[model samples]
Target: MENKMNRRGFFAAMGKFMGLAAVAPAVLGGVFSNQANAQEKRRSAGPGASAVAGSMVDVNDPIAKAVKYVEDFQKSPASKGNKCATCGFYAKKEMHGATEVGTCTIFAGKLVNANGFCASWNKKA
Candidate 1:
């Protein structure tokens, strides 16, 4: 009876160890694959991927409203030193996925047309 019990215990331990060994490689492989995929996504997005969060404004559409806003700022004496490139509200980088479109901090969720302008423009200090 003692000999039979020892044999059964030894086999059970061996089986558990083998099962863990077999699963280890698959778990490690999955982790590595996930890391690789994350790296790929980061590489594709580049540095300015989050510059715009949503749909981009159409350049072909009339931007009179946006342009007028910029023109008003330009005419103001206080805005003499301000420009789209320097504005806090201006999107410094082109929108990801749509290089032609720009983004604006004030416009959240909407990509501004590259040529579009708005009243909230402010120079980056």
Candidate 2:
């Protein structure tokens, strides 16, 4: 009878611990998520920049379609050493302060694909 009582107490303690373990990740994720967002904001800076962060340039946009914009650099005819990142119109310094993606003077406030290509691409001078 005493052993039965001890086993019940142990099971209760373990149940409480398991519940806490499950809730800890959610609580911590919420706490750290804000910090991560703040860091992202710092990285995304440009005109209409709020909407550009983590967004890919739409290939169907008029200019993109007209220019035959290809999202993947490798698939583009300009694949060899050509990409928005190295293009003259790419505003690498003005948007996001990162080269992984940026705005294009041609796109005007819209995010351009980093590994993308277009007919307007010119060698960065």
Q: Each model's C-alpha lDDT? A: 0.59, 0.75
- lDDT score at residue 121, model 1, on the 0-100 scale: 62
Tell me the tens digit of each residue's lDDT in model 2 across 1-125: 99999999999999999999999999999989989997776665644344543455689878789888887778876567588888888765343454466777777657776777888889889
For each candidate in turn, give its C-alpha RMSD to the true structure in angstroms.
8.5, 7.5
Estimate the overall C-alpha local distance difference test score of candidate 1.
0.59
Q: List the residue pairs that clash in candidate 2.
A: none
Residue pairs with backbone overlap in model 1 = 86-124, 87-122
Model 2, position 17: C-alpha lDDT score: 100
Could you tell me the lDDT of residue 118 within candidate 1?
A: 56
